[model samples]
Target: MSLNFNKAEFTRSAAARSGFLRDGRPQFAFAGRSNVGKSSVINRLLGRKNLAYVGASPGKTTQINYFLVDQQAYLVDLPGYGYAKVSKAEKDRWGRLMESYFQDEGGLITTGVLIVDIRHKPTADDVTMHNWFRESGCPEIVVANKLDKLKRSQVEPALELIRQTLELREEDRLVPFSAEKGAGKEELIRLLCEACGQ
Candidate 1:
């Protein structure tokens, strides 16, 4: 089914598990490092400039922010991880929150989108996030964001590096995306629709 993404809007931000929405709509959780441009990717996908709160500083998203798309599925914006400036206590808090969300057997997440910088190799945090998605039994889609930073000739090699570093299955997807140029937006939306069973 085709998703009418034009109707997307900000839903709510949850700092704890108790605040998560229980309306039964499938959620595609977006996860990545603090500076991976995850929020920019979400904004680009929704065709809105600021709907997802692009942060000026790294690791600005301290909660799980939900955006309802066409009032059907939800686009869950998970807090950015791997920011070293945060205190150990804060990191532990974020870790527990993320673990609870991913470990839930009720299947709140319909899919997982792991965004990474297309210009660099995937970091250790990226690998851990990928594993969490796999352990949760949610279909994983790795998005190599910031595609505009690479030259045309460099795109293929960059994508290849991301594929190998993430150790993705042949069936898994690793899309080359550019939030600034809107490249791969349609493909990402199609995947999201497929994940949510629209």
Candidate 2:
């Protein structure tokens, strides 16, 4: 049976590795910089409002949220990284928690979705995440979000910058997305469905 993207439910939030789901389900982990609209992208893909908790002030939430989609696969929301205003200690803690998740022997992430703002160059943290996902040997894709903010002629250059900045190979997928206007939703859904083997 095909996976139903609409039949999603909030499963739990994992503040630490202990709280992570280990039921052997394939996990589609979405990651991004703080304020990159990671939640918005997830919500858009799911065709739901507020399913992933779009924060007014982004980067405050520091937990991994697991959402069960169609009782078949898991959409894991990793904490947004590389935002200012957070304390040094909190950042360290977040770092450790994220490291643990990546280093996990059970292979917690089946597919990695890395979201970046299309208007700016990818940050160091973003590069680190891309490397982490690559090193983990999981199927991954880079989503250039906020596509609506760019002009018609600026899109290609922006995407190329992201691709070059991330050192993405030709086989790596880079999707231009706009969470607000629902552009690129179908492509993202197709990737997710493929990841779940639906």
**Each model's lDDT:** 0.89, 0.90
Instruction: Estimate, for each residue in 93-187, the C-alpha lDDT of model 1 and write its tens digit.
Output: 88988898887757788989999999999999999999999989889999999999989999999989988988888999889999999999999
After superposing candidate 1 on the true structure, give the runs of residues whose Cα lies further than 4 Å from its correct spot: none
- Worst lDDT run of 10 residues, candidate 1, spans 1-10
Write out the backbone clash pairs for model 1.
none
Give me the runs in candidate 2 sitting further than 4 Å from their true place.
none
Clash tally, candidates in order: 0, 0
How big is the RMSD of model 2? 1.3
